[model samples]
Target: MKIVEERISQHFQLYTNFSMNSPIRLYVRFVFVHDGMNGIISSDKRRRVVNALAKAFSSRFVFNHIDLNDQGLYCPDYFRLLKDSEEERYIKAKTQRDPNVYLHIYSADTFDGAKYRNWSSFPWGLEDDPVMDGVVVDYRNIENEESYHWIIHEVGHWFGLVHTFENGCNPPGDYVDDTEAHSDEIRGCPPEGIHNACPEEKRAPINNYMNYTDCKDTFTLGQIERIFRVAKVYRPKLLEPEVCIPPCPPPM
Candidate 1:
Protein backbone atom coordinates (compact mmCIF):
# COMPACT_ATOMS: atom_id res chain seq x y z
CA MET A 1 0.00 0.00 0.00
CA LYS A 2 2.84 2.38 0.80
CA ILE A 3 4.44 1.67 -2.57
CA VAL A 4 1.19 2.52 -4.28
CA GLU A 5 1.21 5.89 -2.58
CA GLU A 6 4.81 6.39 -3.66
CA ARG A 7 4.11 5.47 -7.29
CA ILE A 8 1.98 8.51 -7.88
CA SER A 9 5.06 10.72 -7.69
CA GLN A 10 6.33 9.22 -10.94
CA HIS A 11 2.93 9.04 -12.59
CA PHE A 12 3.49 12.09 -14.73
CA GLN A 13 6.76 10.86 -16.17
CA LEU A 14 5.66 9.63 -19.58
CA TYR A 15 8.07 7.18 -21.27
CA THR A 16 7.99 8.05 -24.96
CA ASN A 17 9.95 8.74 -28.18
CA PHE A 18 10.65 5.13 -28.96
CA SER A 19 11.56 3.97 -32.46
CA MET A 20 9.17 1.82 -34.40
CA ASN A 21 11.54 -1.15 -34.21
CA SER A 22 13.04 -0.66 -30.77
CA PRO A 23 13.24 -3.76 -28.58
CA ILE A 24 10.53 -2.93 -26.10
CA ARG A 25 9.34 -4.92 -23.11
CA LEU A 26 6.38 -4.78 -20.73
CA TYR A 27 5.79 -6.74 -17.51
CA VAL A 28 2.45 -8.41 -16.73
CA ARG A 29 1.72 -9.19 -13.10
CA PHE A 30 -0.82 -12.02 -12.78
CA VAL A 31 -2.37 -11.79 -9.34
CA PHE A 32 -3.99 -15.18 -8.84
CA VAL A 33 -6.77 -15.14 -6.25
CA HIS A 34 -7.93 -18.63 -5.51
CA ASP A 35 -11.58 -19.55 -5.78
CA GLY A 36 -10.44 -23.13 -6.06
CA MET A 37 -7.84 -25.25 -7.83
CA ASN A 38 -9.96 -24.78 -10.92
CA GLY A 39 -8.68 -21.19 -11.17
CA ILE A 40 -5.03 -22.17 -11.30
CA ILE A 41 -3.06 -23.12 -14.37
CA SER A 42 0.60 -24.17 -14.68
CA SER A 43 2.93 -21.27 -15.54
CA ASP A 44 4.51 -23.17 -18.40
CA LYS A 45 1.10 -23.89 -19.87
CA ARG A 46 -0.10 -20.32 -19.41
CA ARG A 47 3.06 -18.98 -20.97
CA ARG A 48 2.50 -21.12 -24.02
CA VAL A 49 -0.93 -19.62 -24.57
CA VAL A 50 0.09 -16.02 -23.84
CA ASN A 51 3.17 -16.10 -25.99
CA ALA A 52 1.20 -16.88 -29.09
CA LEU A 53 -0.12 -13.31 -29.00
CA ALA A 54 3.20 -11.91 -27.85
CA LYS A 55 4.60 -13.31 -31.07
CA ALA A 56 1.98 -11.32 -32.93
CA PHE A 57 3.10 -8.07 -31.26
CA SER A 58 6.70 -8.75 -32.31
CA SER A 59 5.61 -8.83 -35.92
CA ARG A 60 4.45 -5.20 -35.67
CA PHE A 61 6.67 -3.56 -33.09
CA VAL A 62 10.07 -4.42 -31.68
CA PHE A 63 8.12 -5.71 -28.70
CA ASN A 64 9.81 -8.24 -26.44
CA HIS A 65 8.26 -11.07 -24.48
CA ILE A 66 6.03 -10.04 -21.56
CA ASP A 67 7.58 -10.53 -18.12
CA LEU A 68 5.13 -12.62 -16.07
CA ASN A 69 4.58 -12.63 -12.28
CA ASP A 70 2.26 -15.21 -10.71
CA GLN A 71 3.26 -14.62 -7.08
CA GLY A 72 0.70 -11.89 -6.20
CA LEU A 73 -2.55 -13.03 -4.61
CA TYR A 74 -5.99 -11.77 -3.43
CA CYS A 75 -8.28 -13.19 -0.76
CA PRO A 76 -11.52 -14.77 -1.95
CA ASP A 77 -13.82 -11.98 -0.75
CA TYR A 78 -11.64 -9.19 -2.12
CA PHE A 79 -11.31 -11.10 -5.39
CA ARG A 80 -15.07 -11.13 -5.75
CA LEU A 81 -15.16 -7.40 -5.06
CA LEU A 82 -13.09 -7.00 -8.20
CA LYS A 83 -16.24 -7.59 -10.19
CA ASP A 84 -18.58 -5.68 -7.92
CA SER A 85 -17.34 -2.19 -8.80
CA GLU A 86 -14.97 -0.30 -11.05
CA GLU A 87 -13.26 1.42 -8.16
CA GLU A 88 -12.37 -2.01 -6.78
CA ARG A 89 -9.69 -2.09 -9.47
CA TYR A 90 -7.99 0.82 -7.77
CA ILE A 91 -8.06 -1.04 -4.48
CA LYS A 92 -6.53 -4.18 -5.99
CA ALA A 93 -3.77 -2.16 -7.68
CA LYS A 94 -2.81 -0.67 -4.34
CA THR A 95 -2.78 -4.12 -2.74
CA GLN A 96 -0.55 -5.62 -5.41
CA ARG A 97 1.94 -2.82 -5.86
CA ASP A 98 5.29 -3.80 -7.36
CA PRO A 99 7.79 -1.15 -8.40
CA ASN A 100 8.81 -2.88 -11.59
CA VAL A 101 5.44 -4.20 -12.65
CA TYR A 102 3.92 -2.64 -15.79
CA LEU A 103 0.72 -4.46 -16.78
CA HIS A 104 -1.44 -6.19 -14.16
CA ILE A 105 -3.66 -9.15 -15.04
CA TYR A 106 -6.06 -10.37 -12.37
CA SER A 107 -6.89 -14.05 -12.97
CA ALA A 108 -9.91 -15.57 -11.29
CA ASP A 109 -11.69 -18.91 -11.83
CA THR A 110 -14.49 -16.91 -13.37
CA PHE A 111 -15.04 -13.18 -13.80
CA ASP A 112 -17.93 -11.66 -11.87
CA GLY A 113 -19.63 -10.84 -15.14
CA ALA A 114 -19.77 -14.01 -17.24
CA LYS A 115 -20.78 -12.30 -20.47
CA TYR A 116 -17.36 -11.45 -21.92
CA ARG A 117 -14.30 -13.66 -21.65
CA ASN A 118 -12.24 -10.84 -20.06
CA TRP A 119 -12.30 -7.12 -19.29
CA SER A 120 -9.59 -4.48 -18.82
CA SER A 121 -8.92 -0.89 -17.83
CA PHE A 122 -8.63 1.20 -20.96
CA PRO A 123 -5.63 3.44 -21.60
CA TRP A 124 -5.73 5.73 -18.61
CA GLY A 125 -8.90 3.85 -17.55
CA LEU A 126 -7.16 3.53 -14.23
CA GLU A 127 -5.68 7.00 -14.49
CA ASP A 128 -7.60 8.15 -11.45
CA ASP A 129 -6.32 5.00 -9.74
CA PRO A 130 -3.01 4.63 -11.51
CA VAL A 131 -1.73 1.63 -9.58
CA MET A 132 -4.64 -0.64 -10.45
CA ASP A 133 -4.79 0.45 -14.05
CA GLY A 134 -4.53 -2.97 -15.70
CA VAL A 135 -6.61 -5.85 -17.06
CA VAL A 136 -8.72 -8.60 -15.45
CA VAL A 137 -9.02 -11.84 -17.40
CA ASP A 138 -10.78 -15.13 -16.88
CA TYR A 139 -8.25 -17.95 -17.37
CA ARG A 140 -10.84 -19.90 -19.34
CA ASN A 141 -10.85 -17.32 -22.13
CA ILE A 142 -7.14 -17.36 -22.87
CA GLU A 143 -6.98 -21.14 -22.41
CA ASN A 144 -9.46 -21.73 -25.18
CA GLU A 145 -7.60 -22.30 -28.45
CA GLU A 146 -10.65 -21.02 -30.25
CA SER A 147 -10.32 -17.71 -28.37
CA TYR A 148 -6.60 -17.34 -27.69
CA HIS A 149 -6.79 -13.69 -28.65
CA TRP A 150 -8.80 -12.93 -25.52
CA ILE A 151 -5.82 -11.41 -23.74
CA ILE A 152 -4.72 -9.61 -26.87
CA HIS A 153 -8.13 -8.07 -27.31
CA GLU A 154 -8.22 -6.88 -23.71
CA VAL A 155 -4.70 -5.51 -23.93
CA GLY A 156 -5.73 -3.78 -27.11
CA HIS A 157 -8.30 -1.94 -25.06
CA TRP A 158 -5.53 -0.90 -22.69
CA PHE A 159 -3.66 0.34 -25.76
CA GLY A 160 -6.58 2.61 -26.64
CA LEU A 161 -8.51 0.28 -28.95
CA VAL A 162 -12.29 0.16 -28.93
CA HIS A 163 -14.77 -2.42 -30.13
CA THR A 164 -15.25 -2.47 -33.89
CA PHE A 165 -18.83 -1.33 -33.49
CA GLU A 166 -18.04 1.26 -30.84
CA ASN A 167 -20.81 3.91 -30.54
CA GLY A 168 -23.09 1.73 -32.64
CA CYS A 169 -21.41 2.23 -36.04
CA ASN A 170 -22.27 5.82 -36.91
CA PRO A 171 -18.64 6.88 -37.32
CA PRO A 172 -15.15 6.07 -36.11
CA GLY A 173 -15.87 2.42 -35.59
CA ASP A 174 -13.15 1.03 -33.39
CA TYR A 175 -11.18 4.18 -34.41
CA VAL A 176 -8.86 2.12 -36.59
CA ASP A 177 -8.48 2.65 -40.33
CA ASP A 178 -7.95 -0.92 -41.49
CA THR A 179 -10.99 -2.16 -39.53
CA GLU A 180 -14.47 -1.54 -40.88
CA ALA A 181 -17.31 -0.15 -38.77
CA HIS A 182 -20.06 -2.67 -38.22
CA SER A 183 -23.47 -1.55 -36.97
CA ASP A 184 -23.33 -4.18 -34.26
CA GLU A 185 -20.87 -6.71 -32.88
CA ILE A 186 -20.68 -9.84 -34.94
CA ARG A 187 -20.64 -12.81 -32.61
CA GLY A 188 -19.70 -16.49 -33.28
CA CYS A 189 -18.03 -15.43 -36.54
CA PRO A 190 -21.12 -15.79 -38.64
CA PRO A 191 -19.99 -16.13 -42.25
CA GLU A 192 -22.90 -14.22 -43.76
CA GLY A 193 -24.46 -10.78 -43.16
CA ILE A 194 -21.36 -9.22 -41.59
CA HIS A 195 -21.16 -5.74 -43.09
CA ASN A 196 -20.31 -2.16 -42.13
CA ALA A 197 -22.96 0.23 -40.90
CA CYS A 198 -21.86 3.41 -42.72
CA PRO A 199 -21.83 1.81 -46.16
CA GLU A 200 -18.32 2.69 -47.37
CA GLU A 201 -17.48 -1.00 -47.13
CA LYS A 202 -19.56 -4.16 -47.35
CA ARG A 203 -18.07 -6.56 -44.76
CA ALA A 204 -16.75 -6.07 -41.26
CA PRO A 205 -13.34 -7.27 -40.31
CA ILE A 206 -14.67 -10.15 -38.25
CA ASN A 207 -11.18 -11.59 -37.93
CA ASN A 208 -9.91 -8.35 -36.43
CA TYR A 209 -8.88 -8.92 -32.82
CA MET A 210 -10.94 -5.93 -31.60
CA ASN A 211 -14.17 -7.49 -32.80
CA TYR A 212 -15.91 -10.12 -30.64
CA THR A 213 -16.35 -12.40 -33.63
CA ASP A 214 -15.81 -16.04 -32.62
CA CYS A 215 -12.49 -16.54 -34.41
CA LYS A 216 -10.29 -13.44 -33.89
CA ASP A 217 -6.98 -14.19 -35.55
CA THR A 218 -5.56 -10.92 -36.87
CA PHE A 219 -4.79 -7.24 -36.22
CA THR A 220 -4.81 -4.80 -39.10
CA LEU A 221 -1.90 -2.40 -39.61
CA GLY A 222 -4.13 0.38 -38.32
CA GLN A 223 -4.73 -1.44 -35.05
CA ILE A 224 -1.02 -2.16 -34.74
CA GLU A 225 -0.16 1.45 -35.40
CA ARG A 226 -2.75 2.62 -32.88
CA ILE A 227 -1.47 0.19 -30.25
CA PHE A 228 2.17 1.23 -30.59
CA ARG A 229 1.16 4.87 -30.67
CA VAL A 230 -0.57 4.60 -27.33
CA ALA A 231 2.20 2.41 -25.98
CA LYS A 232 4.63 5.14 -26.90
CA VAL A 233 2.69 7.90 -25.17
CA TYR A 234 0.17 6.81 -22.56
CA ARG A 235 1.69 3.41 -21.73
CA PRO A 236 5.35 4.22 -22.23
CA LYS A 237 6.51 1.56 -19.77
CA LEU A 238 5.35 -1.02 -22.27
CA LEU A 239 7.81 0.39 -24.78
CA GLU A 240 10.83 0.21 -22.50
CA PRO A 241 12.69 -2.76 -21.02
CA GLU A 242 11.45 -3.81 -17.61
CA VAL A 243 13.64 -2.44 -14.82
CA CYS A 244 13.37 -5.51 -12.57
CA ILE A 245 13.02 -9.02 -13.89
CA PRO A 246 10.29 -10.58 -11.77
CA PRO A 247 10.54 -13.70 -13.93
CA CYS A 248 10.76 -14.26 -17.65
CA PRO A 249 8.17 -16.16 -19.65
CA PRO A 250 9.24 -19.84 -19.87
CA PRO A 251 11.35 -20.43 -22.95
CA MET A 252 9.25 -20.86 -26.06
Candidate 2:
Protein backbone atom coordinates (compact mmCIF):
# COMPACT_ATOMS: atom_id res chain seq x y z
CA MET A 1 0.00 0.00 0.00
CA LYS A 2 2.79 2.44 0.92
CA ILE A 3 4.43 1.69 -2.40
CA VAL A 4 1.31 2.62 -4.34
CA GLU A 5 0.81 5.91 -2.51
CA GLU A 6 4.43 6.96 -2.98
CA ARG A 7 4.37 6.27 -6.71
CA ILE A 8 1.11 8.17 -7.20
CA SER A 9 2.16 11.18 -5.14
CA GLN A 10 5.54 11.44 -6.84
CA HIS A 11 3.96 11.53 -10.28
CA PHE A 12 1.13 13.86 -9.23
CA GLN A 13 3.41 16.32 -7.40
CA LEU A 14 5.25 17.01 -10.63
CA TYR A 15 2.33 19.21 -11.57
CA THR A 16 2.25 22.55 -9.76
CA ASN A 17 -1.31 23.69 -10.49
CA PHE A 18 -3.48 20.92 -9.02
CA SER A 19 -6.83 21.77 -7.41
CA MET A 20 -10.49 20.85 -7.10
CA ASN A 21 -11.20 22.34 -10.53
CA SER A 22 -8.48 20.82 -12.70
CA PRO A 23 -9.22 18.99 -15.95
CA ILE A 24 -9.74 15.23 -15.81
CA ARG A 25 -6.75 13.05 -16.55
CA LEU A 26 -6.49 9.59 -15.04
CA TYR A 27 -3.68 7.05 -14.59
CA VAL A 28 -5.23 3.78 -13.48
CA ARG A 29 -3.45 0.84 -11.84
CA PHE A 30 -5.68 -2.18 -11.27
CA VAL A 31 -4.55 -4.45 -8.41
CA PHE A 32 -6.77 -7.51 -8.15
CA VAL A 33 -6.73 -9.36 -4.83
CA HIS A 34 -8.98 -12.40 -4.95
CA ASP A 35 -10.24 -13.82 -1.70
CA GLY A 36 -8.94 -17.40 -1.37
CA MET A 37 -12.34 -18.63 -0.39
CA ASN A 38 -13.92 -17.05 -3.45
CA GLY A 39 -13.78 -18.16 -7.07
CA ILE A 40 -12.49 -15.85 -9.80
CA ILE A 41 -14.26 -15.44 -13.07
CA SER A 42 -11.32 -16.37 -15.57
CA SER A 43 -8.72 -13.82 -16.72
CA ASP A 44 -10.01 -13.73 -20.32
CA LYS A 45 -13.52 -13.08 -19.07
CA ARG A 46 -12.37 -10.31 -16.78
CA ARG A 47 -10.42 -8.67 -19.61
CA ARG A 48 -13.48 -8.59 -21.84
CA VAL A 49 -15.48 -6.94 -19.10
CA VAL A 50 -12.84 -4.28 -18.48
CA ASN A 51 -12.46 -3.45 -22.16
CA ALA A 52 -16.17 -2.96 -22.61
CA LEU A 53 -16.25 -0.56 -19.69
CA ALA A 54 -13.25 1.46 -20.92
CA LYS A 55 -15.24 2.40 -23.99
CA ALA A 56 -17.38 4.75 -21.90
CA PHE A 57 -14.36 6.90 -20.97
CA SER A 58 -13.12 7.54 -24.51
CA SER A 59 -15.46 10.42 -25.26
CA ARG A 60 -14.99 12.51 -22.11
CA PHE A 61 -11.67 11.72 -20.40
CA VAL A 62 -8.01 10.84 -20.94
CA PHE A 63 -6.59 7.96 -18.95
CA ASN A 64 -3.83 5.31 -18.92
CA HIS A 65 -4.32 1.82 -17.51
CA ILE A 66 -1.73 -0.30 -15.67
CA ASP A 67 -2.57 -3.71 -14.28
CA LEU A 68 -0.97 -4.47 -10.93
CA ASN A 69 0.19 -8.00 -10.13
CA ASP A 70 -2.16 -10.72 -8.86
CA GLN A 71 0.50 -13.02 -7.39
CA GLY A 72 -0.40 -12.92 -3.73
CA LEU A 73 -1.42 -16.30 -2.30
CA TYR A 74 -4.82 -14.97 -1.33
CA CYS A 75 -5.36 -11.25 -1.63
CA PRO A 76 -2.77 -8.43 -1.64
CA ASP A 77 -0.86 -8.10 1.64
CA TYR A 78 -2.35 -4.66 2.13
CA PHE A 79 -5.90 -5.97 1.94
CA ARG A 80 -5.50 -8.01 5.13
CA LEU A 81 -6.27 -4.87 7.11
CA LEU A 82 -9.43 -4.13 5.16
CA LYS A 83 -11.70 -3.98 8.18
CA ASP A 84 -14.28 -1.20 8.55
CA SER A 85 -12.18 0.44 11.27
CA GLU A 86 -9.28 1.04 8.88
CA GLU A 87 -11.32 3.50 6.90
CA GLU A 88 -9.20 5.97 4.91
CA ARG A 89 -5.97 4.25 5.95
CA TYR A 90 -4.83 4.20 2.31
CA ILE A 91 -4.54 8.00 2.26
CA LYS A 92 -1.97 8.00 5.08
CA ALA A 93 -0.13 4.82 4.03
CA LYS A 94 2.65 5.58 1.57
CA THR A 95 3.76 2.76 -0.68
CA GLN A 96 7.28 3.62 -1.88
CA ARG A 97 6.72 6.96 -0.12
CA ASP A 98 4.43 8.34 -2.86
CA PRO A 99 0.76 9.12 -2.33
CA ASN A 100 -1.06 9.21 -5.66
CA VAL A 101 -1.48 5.72 -7.09
CA TYR A 102 -4.68 4.32 -5.59
CA LEU A 103 -5.62 0.71 -4.89
CA HIS A 104 -9.03 -0.94 -4.94
CA ILE A 105 -9.64 -4.49 -3.75
CA TYR A 106 -11.64 -6.38 -6.35
CA SER A 107 -13.84 -9.12 -4.93
CA ALA A 108 -16.24 -11.70 -6.41
CA ASP A 109 -19.00 -13.40 -4.48
CA THR A 110 -22.24 -15.35 -5.01
CA PHE A 111 -24.64 -12.99 -3.33
CA ASP A 112 -27.73 -15.18 -3.82
CA GLY A 113 -30.36 -12.44 -3.80
CA ALA A 114 -28.41 -9.37 -2.74
CA LYS A 115 -28.48 -6.21 -4.79
CA TYR A 116 -25.66 -3.96 -5.91
CA ARG A 117 -25.07 -1.46 -3.15
CA ASN A 118 -22.29 1.07 -2.42
CA TRP A 119 -18.70 0.46 -3.52
CA SER A 120 -17.77 -0.41 0.03
CA SER A 121 -21.31 -1.12 1.09
CA PHE A 122 -21.55 2.48 2.33
CA PRO A 123 -22.17 5.94 0.87
CA TRP A 124 -18.61 7.16 1.37
CA GLY A 125 -16.03 5.73 -1.08
CA LEU A 126 -12.95 6.29 1.04
CA GLU A 127 -12.38 7.83 4.43
CA ASP A 128 -9.83 10.37 3.23
CA ASP A 129 -11.21 11.60 -0.11
CA PRO A 130 -14.74 10.22 0.12
CA VAL A 131 -14.64 9.38 -3.60
CA MET A 132 -11.42 7.39 -3.92
CA ASP A 133 -10.26 3.95 -2.88
CA GLY A 134 -12.57 1.09 -1.86
CA VAL A 135 -13.75 -2.43 -2.77
CA VAL A 136 -16.31 -2.92 -5.53
CA VAL A 137 -18.57 -5.56 -7.12
CA ASP A 138 -19.63 -8.96 -5.94
CA TYR A 139 -20.88 -12.02 -7.89
CA ARG A 140 -24.55 -11.12 -7.67
CA ASN A 141 -24.13 -7.70 -9.31
CA ILE A 142 -22.36 -8.74 -12.53
CA GLU A 143 -22.98 -12.46 -12.65
CA ASN A 144 -24.44 -12.51 -16.13
CA GLU A 145 -23.56 -9.15 -17.55
CA GLU A 146 -20.57 -9.80 -19.83
CA SER A 147 -20.35 -6.06 -20.46
CA TYR A 148 -18.48 -5.42 -17.20
CA HIS A 149 -20.82 -2.48 -16.70
CA TRP A 150 -20.85 -3.04 -12.95
CA ILE A 151 -17.08 -2.74 -12.75
CA ILE A 152 -17.24 0.45 -14.76
CA HIS A 153 -19.96 1.80 -12.49
CA GLU A 154 -17.82 1.32 -9.37
CA VAL A 155 -14.71 2.62 -11.10
CA GLY A 156 -16.75 5.61 -12.15
CA HIS A 157 -17.32 6.31 -8.48
CA TRP A 158 -13.60 5.89 -7.81
CA PHE A 159 -13.18 8.46 -10.55
CA GLY A 160 -15.68 10.67 -8.70
CA LEU A 161 -19.38 10.34 -9.50
CA VAL A 162 -22.33 10.37 -7.12
CA HIS A 163 -25.62 8.50 -7.36
CA THR A 164 -28.04 10.32 -9.73
CA PHE A 165 -30.88 11.03 -7.27
CA GLU A 166 -29.34 11.95 -3.92
CA ASN A 167 -31.87 14.24 -2.25
CA GLY A 168 -35.02 16.33 -2.71
CA CYS A 169 -33.20 19.54 -3.64
CA ASN A 170 -30.90 17.74 -6.10
CA PRO A 171 -28.01 19.26 -4.16
CA PRO A 172 -26.99 15.72 -3.28
CA GLY A 173 -26.94 14.76 -6.95
CA ASP A 174 -23.77 14.76 -8.97
CA TYR A 175 -23.65 18.45 -9.95
CA VAL A 176 -23.63 18.12 -13.72
CA ASP A 177 -25.70 20.40 -15.96
CA ASP A 178 -27.34 17.98 -18.41
CA THR A 179 -28.37 15.37 -15.85
CA GLU A 180 -31.92 15.73 -14.64
CA ALA A 181 -32.34 16.89 -11.05
CA HIS A 182 -33.42 13.55 -9.67
CA SER A 183 -35.15 13.54 -6.30
CA ASP A 184 -34.83 9.77 -5.83
CA GLU A 185 -32.68 6.87 -7.03
CA ILE A 186 -33.88 4.96 -10.08
CA ARG A 187 -33.73 1.22 -9.42
CA GLY A 188 -35.25 -0.21 -12.61
CA CYS A 189 -35.28 0.86 -16.24
CA PRO A 190 -36.43 4.41 -16.92
CA PRO A 191 -37.43 6.00 -20.21
CA GLU A 192 -34.68 6.67 -22.73
CA GLY A 193 -34.52 10.31 -21.61
CA ILE A 194 -36.60 10.43 -18.45
CA HIS A 195 -35.69 13.90 -17.23
CA ASN A 196 -36.78 14.78 -13.69
CA ALA A 197 -35.87 18.44 -14.39
CA CYS A 198 -34.84 19.07 -10.82
CA PRO A 199 -32.16 21.79 -10.43
CA GLU A 200 -32.93 22.98 -13.94
CA GLU A 201 -35.44 22.48 -16.71
CA LYS A 202 -33.97 19.51 -18.56
CA ARG A 203 -34.66 15.86 -19.33
CA ALA A 204 -33.30 13.23 -16.97
CA PRO A 205 -30.43 11.02 -18.13
CA ILE A 206 -31.92 7.62 -17.39
CA ASN A 207 -29.03 5.73 -18.97
CA ASN A 208 -26.31 7.36 -16.87
CA TYR A 209 -24.45 5.15 -14.38
CA MET A 210 -25.08 7.60 -11.57
CA ASN A 211 -28.82 7.45 -11.96
CA TYR A 212 -30.55 5.05 -9.59
CA THR A 213 -33.40 4.45 -12.03
CA ASP A 214 -32.82 1.21 -13.90
CA CYS A 215 -32.75 1.75 -17.66
CA LYS A 216 -30.75 0.96 -20.75
CA ASP A 217 -27.03 1.19 -19.96
CA THR A 218 -25.89 4.55 -21.26
CA PHE A 219 -24.08 7.72 -20.22
CA THR A 220 -25.29 11.20 -20.92
CA LEU A 221 -23.06 13.94 -22.34
CA GLY A 222 -23.56 15.86 -19.12
CA GLN A 223 -22.48 12.87 -17.03
CA ILE A 224 -19.35 12.62 -19.13
CA GLU A 225 -18.60 16.27 -18.44
CA ARG A 226 -18.93 15.74 -14.71
CA ILE A 227 -16.59 12.73 -14.87
CA PHE A 228 -14.05 14.73 -16.78
CA ARG A 229 -14.26 17.54 -14.28
CA VAL A 230 -13.80 15.25 -11.32
CA ALA A 231 -10.86 13.44 -12.89
CA LYS A 232 -9.16 16.72 -13.71
CA VAL A 233 -9.41 17.90 -10.13
CA TYR A 234 -8.22 14.75 -8.38
CA ARG A 235 -6.23 12.21 -10.41
CA PRO A 236 -3.95 14.25 -12.65
CA LYS A 237 -1.44 11.42 -12.66
CA LEU A 238 -3.87 9.65 -15.00
CA LEU A 239 -3.04 12.38 -17.49
CA GLU A 240 0.55 11.21 -17.84
CA PRO A 241 1.53 9.75 -21.19
CA GLU A 242 1.26 6.07 -22.11
CA VAL A 243 2.52 3.94 -24.96
CA CYS A 244 0.76 4.73 -28.21
CA ILE A 245 -1.16 1.54 -28.70
CA PRO A 246 -4.66 0.63 -29.74
CA PRO A 247 -7.33 1.65 -27.20
CA CYS A 248 -7.64 -1.63 -25.39
CA PRO A 249 -8.66 -1.57 -21.69
CA PRO A 250 -6.00 -2.42 -19.06
CA PRO A 251 -5.03 -6.09 -18.62
CA MET A 252 -6.22 -7.88 -15.48
Best by TM-score: 1
- For residues 30-62, write the lDDT of model 2, one tens digit per residue: 333346644344555454555556576553454
Global Cα lDDT for candidate 2: 0.47
TM-scores for all predictions: 0.76, 0.61
Model 2, stretches more than 4 Å misplaced? 1-37, 59-99, 102-105, 110-132, 140-143, 171-173, 192-202, 242-252
Clashes of 1: 0
Q: Among these predicted structures, which one has the highest lDDT?
A: 1
Compose the digit string of candidate 1's lDDT tens values, residues 1-252: 224323422442443443467544665555655545445656665666557757656554432335344543545555554453664554465556542236666666555565644777766444465655666777675556665677778877866788888866565446567777777777786664446545677777778788887778877777776676655545666566545464554554
- Alpha-carbon local distance difference test for all models: 0.61, 0.47
